[model samples]
Target: MIMMDEIVLFNPGDSIGNFHDYHEAVQTAQIYQERHTESGHVVVVKSDNGAPSFDIFLAEQQLDNGQKNPSTSKRYTISKKL
Candidate 1:
């Protein structure tokens, strides 16, 4: 298998967009999430080995239980630089 970092934008209807650049993927996700506020889309960034580095979600959602609440989405940061 080819080894490289990956970014995926998970949109409504379980549709996904694959990307190699994390920032680009995140931007796309943000745009989609903003445009489709009712869709509840999310973004995932992974390392070369498939370990998740970042999980971006719609606002007012919980990361632990995958539940929606009034709190902002939780963010995980592996490093200062992407």
Candidate 2:
């Protein structure tokens, strides 16, 4: 399993643009999915490395009961440093 540190940090409601390579795209996707695997107050993943990836809304759940609230579709846009 890939470690959390290895996965790039993403936020909700971010926009993604063109991707440079397929590996970057795949990595972004993997991290996006991982963020949703857990319950309760999850953060969406976004990559601005110009990598093609999916944008999923992370829903926050009750810490004690694990009940998730309605997920708000937040856009995540990642940017690269030129």
lDDT per residue for candidate 2 within 1-82, as digits (tens), equals 8734323333333333224464565455456556645533333334444555444333331122222432432233422211
TM-score of each: 0.39, 0.25
Winner by lDDT: 1
lDDT of model 1 at position 6? 32
**lDDT of each residue in 1-82, candidate 1, tens digit only:** 9954432222222224545667766777777767877866354434334544433444333244453641443333321111
Clashing pairs in 1: none
Off-target runs (Cα >4 Å) in candidate 1 are 1-15, 47-82
Q: What would the TM-score be for candidate 2 when compared with the true structure?
A: 0.25
Each model's backbone clash number: 0, 13
User: Which prediction has the highest TM-score against the true structure?
Assistant: 1
